[model samples]
Target: MHIFEGFLPSPWWQVWFAISIPVIMYGIYQMNKLVSQRREIVPLLAVAGAFIFVLSSLKLPSVTGSSSHPTGTGMAAILFGPAVTSVLSVIVLLYQSLFLAHGGLTTLGANVFSMGIAGPFVAYALYKVASKAGMNFYLNVFLATAIADWVTYVVTSLQLALAFPFEGSVFASFKMFALVFATTQVPLAIMEGALTALIMKYVVQVKSDVLVGLNVLTSSAATKLREAME
Candidate 1:
């Protein structure tokens, strides 16, 4: 749910915006560090960002009669790490706000925290766990994206609840939101995972050397992807 302007309590929102500034700054700083280490990959990141921007422009119909688009932050995080994804997400959100008006400027920080921060971190964590558990590649992709998307929504719901006073229990509000949005969000997560895996496979194939230098693609996986791409 896009929390547009005037949707939250002004006082609480002001406090959240203030708190969010340093958090966004820290994320930006982290992205800068990551970018410095991977100077050659920066061009690839721009390509990926453009791909995400286009992909995100497409919306799929939901059971609730609302359409939702996939947030490509998880895919970016998988390739560039979450730090870069956080900054990329803010940029993407900003562009969407200005061009599409999908989410408002006032609530952009909150959106960044939810979709950008939470989505990428959760996806990265899940991917790491699944890899450690020796899960299959596709399953790892599926679960990571799914969990990350759900986490994004959950975090957003909490933000909304915290921003405004609800008449009932906070848990209840979350549950209600989950029920309404889960149908779309859950499937979106699966799509995100699959799409992320496909795109990453392409990236690894074309430039395994680059990924290896960044420690993102192992030699073997890179070789395999390269062969497949060829």
Candidate 2:
């Protein structure tokens, strides 16, 4: 969800920008490192960008008298790893801002922090933890998307609260956010989780080569697939 324009007062807005500049620079640095390490990932990044572009453009009705869309960050994170996914998301968000204005320039950093950084990273972390615990892969994928998608909105809602402080009523702001956003977000999370799992399964089976190119499918995973086919 977009933070409405002019939501923040001047001083806090200035602080937000100040904090964000270094984060943006760090993202750029990380992107450059990933490109160097995995030269083939450049094309995949473009593909991921296009996928997110399409996903973000599709709007679903929200209870808040607005619409929202999937960021598709969980899939990206599962594909390229979270560090690279952050950069991927920043690029996609930039493109969306320039073309679609789905998100605003002034609030761009906050959006990046919420949707780009929090969403994919949180999901990937969940996947890793679940995998380590010997949880089923599909279940891990589902939990990843659900938690990430839910947390993204939580972060966004908190940001909105920070940006627009109500008159001495913090709980009021939180209640408003929960009422308006949670209904649509819950269903969207389930959809994103299922979609991510399907896509990942397809890639691991029919398009193992693509995952190899993305540097996501380990040699062991590839070998297991080939052996199973044999």
Candidate 3:
């Protein structure tokens, strides 16, 4: 879901742009490293971006100036990191704004923050945490991906609340915006999680060696994930 053009108002929109610019720059640097050193990673990046574009394009009317949809950043975050995924998201968002007319150019920074930075960071962090906890590999992916989708909406609601506090209450506005998204987002999150897990499982089976060779997965982790998928 994107924050529509001009709905964010003045300093708020500018502030988000300011915050997002540095991250986008860093993400570009990160991606440059891969594009230069590990050219093989480009295909994986394309797949991840495709997942984001295809899944997020499915929109449902949720609130004024916004809509509900599955944010497909999780797999990218899982494959690369949040920073790299942020760059991917900027590309996807820019395309949607220009061609699909789904999100607006004015609100791209806000949309990127919620869907790209915050959400993917949460997913990557959760995946790390779940791995450390000795959780099942696919289950960890499912949980991380699902929770990332939910976190994106929560951050979006917070952004909205900050811009337009209800009766001088940001918390109240946050609650309101969150509730509006909750109806559709909850189920979408589960479906996204399942979908991501399935795709990752297939990758583990087909690309296990490549993942290890690229250091995206350690030999041991790759073996475990492959067996777990089986």
Candidate 4:
């Protein structure tokens, strides 16, 4: 969900900017270094960014003048981790803000935090946990992507509640906002999960080596998947 432009109070937006800047910088540095070492990742990253741009741009109206949509961060987070995903998210958000007017410049940092950093980090953590548990690969992707999409909306609601406490109580506002988003977001998340799962399945079948290179699939897992594909 996008918090929209001018939704946050001035100080709140500034605070988010302060929090996001350092991480974004580090992400840029990391992405540059990684691409330099593994040029093959560049096209994958581009596709990931484009996916995010398209998915997140499709917004459904929600509470407090905000809107809900699929974050599209989970797959990228699983592939490149949250840091690089953050960089890609910011770029997508910026482009949306400029031409699409989906979000706003002042609210960019807050959007980045919720949709980029928080969601992707959670997705990565869940993916690792699912993998370590030896879960089915498709199920792991579904859980990670679905849960991450939901978490992004959760964070956005919290951000809105914080900026505008309802009846002078932030908790109440948070609940209100969360409830509003849940109406549309839940089904959207499920759909995104299914789609992401299919994409992962295709990648595992056709380019298991890419997953192996990203450490998403261990060599043994990649080999097993390739054999299954055969």
User: Which one wins on TM-score?
Assistant: 4
> TM-score of every model?
0.83, 0.83, 0.87, 0.88
Model 3: per-residue lDDT, tens digit, 23-120?
Answer: 99999998988789978778888776877788777764443334556678887888778889999999999888887787778799999999899999
Alpha carbon lDDT at 205, candidate 3:
93
Count of clashing residue pairs in every prediction = 0, 0, 0, 0
> Which stretches of model 4 miss by more than 4 angstroms?
39-44, 55-69, 226-230
Give the TM-score (vs. native) of candidate 4: 0.88
The best candidate by lDDT is 4
- Encode model 2's per-residue lDDT on 1-230: one tens digit a residue: 55544665666556666665666677778888878987886886788789878977876454455466777888777776777777777778778878886676777777777787878888888887777786766667778987888888887887767756679676678768866878778777877777777667666677787767655555676667556656
The TM-score, computed over Cα atoms with residue i paired to residue i, of candidate 2 is 0.83
Q: Which residue segments of model 2 deviate by more than 4 Å? A: 59-68, 212-230
Pairs in clash, predicted candidate 1: none
Provide the lowest-lDDT 10-residue window in model 3: 59-68
TM-score of 3: 0.87
| Model 4: worst 10 consecutive residues (lDDT sum) | 60-69
- For candidate 2, what's the RMSD? 3.2
Where in model 1 is the C-alpha error above 4 Å? 35-38, 60-66, 202-210, 224-230
lDDT of 1 by residue, 60-129 (tens): 5444565777777776676667777777777788888888878877787788888888888888888777
Q: At residue 15, what lDDT does model 2 achieve?
A: 68
